[model samples]
Target: MGIILMFMLLASVTPFLFLQLKKTVFALVQTILLVGMWLYFFEVVFQAAPAAFSIPWIMFYASLFVAEVGWVMFIIRLIKTSSTVQESFQ
Candidate 1:
C-alpha cells in the first residue's frame, strides 16, 4: 500500500523537477532517464514487458537508480542556486 503510494508520488513529481533544470546537457540526460523510468513503470504495470524478464527485481533496481539520480541532481542544483553560502568554520 505504502509502496504504491510512493510510486504515485514519484510519477507525479518527476516532470516538475525536470523543469527546474532546462536547456543543458545534464538536463537532457535526466530527461532521457526520466522517460525511461516511466516507460518501464508503465510497461511493467500493464504487463507489456517481455515474458522472460524478471519484472519485480529489475523494476525495483531501476526505480531506485532513477530516483536516486534524479533527487541527487535536484539537490545539487538547489544548493548551487542558494542565495547564501554556508558559514566558514575557521
Candidate 2:
C-alpha cells in the first residue's frame, strides 16, 4: 500500500514539475510517459483492469520501455530540425 502510493506520487509529481517549468512538446510527452509508466506499475502489482494476455495489457507493459524510444526520437528530430551553420541561406 505505502509503496504503491509513494511511487504514484513520484510518478505524477516529477512530470508535473517539468511541465510547469516548460510548457512545450517535450514536457507533454514526458507527462504522458511518466503517468503511463505509473499505470503499468500499478497494474503489475494489483492486477487491475485489463487481463494479463491482452493488447491493452501489453501496451501498459510497453510504457515501461517506451521512454527510451521517446527520448531518442525527440533527440533525433531536434537534430534534424536544427540549423547546420550560424545562419540559414533561405
Candidate 3:
C-alpha cells in the first residue's frame, strides 16, 4: 500500500514534467505509469485491504481518476501544441 501510494504520487507529477518537456517519450512514460499505478492499486491494495478501509479506498481511487483525467487532457493539449509548432516550422 505504501509503495502504491508512493508510485501514485510520482505518477501525478510526471504529466506536468511531460508538458514542460514536450517530449513524446515523457508522455508515453506518463501514460504507462498512470495505468500501471491504477492496476497495482486495484489488484494489490484493493484485494488486500479489509472492509474497514472502504472509504479511504474510494477516496484514493477517486483522486487517482481525477488525476488521470487531468493528465490525459494535458497530454492532448501538449500534442496539439506540438503539432502547431511543427506546422509553423514547415
Candidate 4:
C-alpha cells in the first residue's frame, strides 16, 4: 500500500520536477502513467506485498525503461529546438 502510494506520488511529480525540459513534460507524463498503471496492476491484480522483496531487477528494469525513453525524447526535442534557434540566427 505505502509502496504503491510512494510510486504514485513519484509519477505525479516527475514531470514537474523536470520543468527545464518543457517539451519533455509529455514524455514524462507518459512514462509516469505507464509506471503507475504497472504498479497498480501488481498491487491490485497480483496482490504483491511491500515487504523486503528481493527483486532489484524488476525495479531497475521498469524504472530505467521509462526514464530512458523519456530522456531520449527529451534530448531529441532539445537538440531540434536548439538547432532551429541557431538556424534562425543565420
Against the true structure, whose TM-score is highest? Answer: 3
For candidate 1, the per-residue lDDT at 37 reads 56
Error of 4 at 77 (Å): 0.3
Candidate 4 lDDT over 1-90, as tens digits, reads 676556545544445534656646565655555564556446655675443433433543465455555556667878899999999999
Superposed Cα deviation of residue 60, candidate 1 (Å): 6.6
Give the RMSD in angstroms, all C-alphas superposed, for model 4: 7.8
Candidate 2 global lDDT: 0.55
What's the residue-level lDDT of 62 in candidate 3?
Answer: 53
lDDT tens string, model 2, 1-90?
Answer: 686566445545544444544546655665666666666667667975666756545544454344444445555655666755324755
List, residue by residue over 1-90, the lDDT tens digit for candidate 3.
586577488667766666665666666655665664565467654576434346545545555665566567677887999999999999
Better structure of 3 and 4 per TM-score: 3
Ranking by TM-score: 3, 1, 4, 2
| Model 4 ranges with Cα > 4 A deviation | 1-14, 17-60
In angstroms, the error of model 1 at 51 is: 5.8
All-Cα superposition RMSD per candidate: 5.2, 7.7, 8.8, 7.8
Query: lDDT per prediction?
Result: 0.59, 0.55, 0.63, 0.57
lDDT of 1 by residue, 1-90 (tens): 468557646744654566666635545554555555556667667876544446544544555565566677788888876634553421
Candidate 3 accuracy as lDDT: 0.63
Model 3 residue runs over 4 Å out of place are 1-3, 11-53
Clash pairs of candidate 1?
none
Candidate 4 CA-lDDT value: 0.57
